[model samples]
Target: MAQLIDSLRADGICIIVVTHDMDLVKALDARLVYLIPDRPGAGKVSGGPVQSPDGPDGSRPVLLPVAAMDQRDEPPRRSSRSAYIASINPAFRLIGAFLTALPLLISLDWVSATVALVLELFLLMAAGFTPLRIVRSAWPIFLGAPGSALAIILYGKAGGATYWQWGMIHVTQRSLDLALATALRILAIGIPAIITVLGIDATDLADAFSQVLHLPERFVYGGLAGLRLFSVLRDDWSALSASRRSRGLGDENRFKAFFPQAFALLVLSIRRSTTLATAMEARGFGGTEERTHARVSDVGPRDYVYLLICLAVPVAALATAALTGRISYFGN
Candidate 1:
């Protein structure tokens, strides 16, 4: 591994190594970049060559000295109640999201879609999410729903009473009904997925996928590893932007500066990925035999309840629409 890193360095390639292995860092003579969390969505970075305390042959990474931020004095408080959406097995939650979304996508009537939307809102609240949190996380749906509805209202198949007509655009009672149904359907499908998936831990999801869903362990772990880099990328972007501002480049057009910074981020991501892949290889990640999980993932009664809700909401929505004579099958 040391020889590989040395060779890469010799080839004029820069490597960014992210690891706790001090020996590996020493072998590569890599500078340390310390990320100290000073606040939510913000942090401080201290970077320099760190000298090992054990006379340059230490087996542990040298801890960088970071000044205590005043904000760190009070830690964030934890919620007393466990999040309902996060408690269910991730596999079950995923399957439930799929089941709940499928019907909303297929239903072509306002009544069924409205029922599904109401049920989805109830589920979101049941999952312990506040209305503000739901809107914050699923704002795209809120915006896109109205936009989609307007598009459908203007361009959807026109029938029933004609309200307006223009070049390549028509509005009618049937089209307006379909538009409302489409908007409600978007909310129904999107809200549940966003609410359930927002707080899921990547590691837990990986475990559930590998153990409960019988997915390929290598693929699951690799994907989880990749997901871990998302936060790092965000931090890198913040740091990069800050550095640019400090260099008096902040006044430049952001659109012009975006490409260079994005390219730099892409380079950093590739280097990190290479290092991660090497570390995984060293840990025998892609061995032919199956590996055991440290923690077992299981589906229980709560998971069953989630699945039941997923199944029930769509059925009840369709049933209500049928009874009200508002059921409109797709394509007819």
Candidate 2:
């Protein structure tokens, strides 16, 4: 890999490697691009020569002043409320999502599900997600909801008066009610969970899981590493498609072409994962000894407040359902 990088550099190709393995950077003698956060939403990159910590004099890497480096303009900041929500501990957000989802998941009637969906929508808006953005991001949920509801109406456990029947497909009044409830329940549970996850930074989540939640560092960091590969996999797919088109294989049957590309992708992923695992082991990633965190993942009063809100949403939904005489348990 180092030889390939060196060869590419010799050919005047810019090979950018994003990694935490400082040893590899030192070995490559690569220029460092440090991203320094200048504001809440903005960062400035400062580049400098990499220094080896294992040098005879044990010199450390130097970070040039922001003014000395080529600087970019600051990005716009989000609303304070939005920023606060985003800053909350990801572990808490995860717990909050679970709390909010429980009631909606078990809801068997339309009223409770409807109430939960409304609350989730309100929460979404409060969290600064616009209606269009929510629809765009959660389009799969929107598209699948109706289809799922239709399936449920057609083939769900039949009860009450029959509305339609054709061969194996049957629709009844009870099925209709259940279908509507199911659709609303999906929206109520899925939207907020997706939004919460999208809002979290992968690195921040890993840090929270490791430092705040006391999860195994190996597992947390491994997951983070895998998540980072998603973008790489997307680019690889695009490149693979382009290569196939250039090779006159694009006109081949789509299903048949897919199998080869999928196999190639799997091979590429496995190779990358193996390389990453080796690098991580070299960096003492899976060591049994205690590891110190560079970033602190402390929970504060605001986090507690966020947790309370998470707890309150489901409680309120359930209470409202009970008052309306609409609460139906899972097996009712």
The weakest ten consecutive residues by lDDT in model 2 span 68-77
Query: What are the TM-scores, per candidate, against the unseen true structure?
Result: 0.64, 0.65
lDDT of 1 by residue, 103-215 (tens): 66666888998898887777677767678878888899999999999999999999999999999899999899989888888888898777666666677788889889998
Q: What does candidate 2's lDDT look like per residue over 1-332, in tens digits?
A: 77899899999998888776777877777766654444433343335433345433454444433432223443422312356667678888898888888756766777877877787788778878789988887888898889989999999878899989999888999889889988988887787777766657677689889988898888889889999878898899988899999999999999999999999889989999999899889778878877765566768998888888777777787788899998887777
Every model: Cα RMSD to truth: 12.3, 8.7
| lDDT, model 1 | 0.78
Q: After superposition, how far is residue 45 of candidate 2 from its true place, in Å?
A: 30
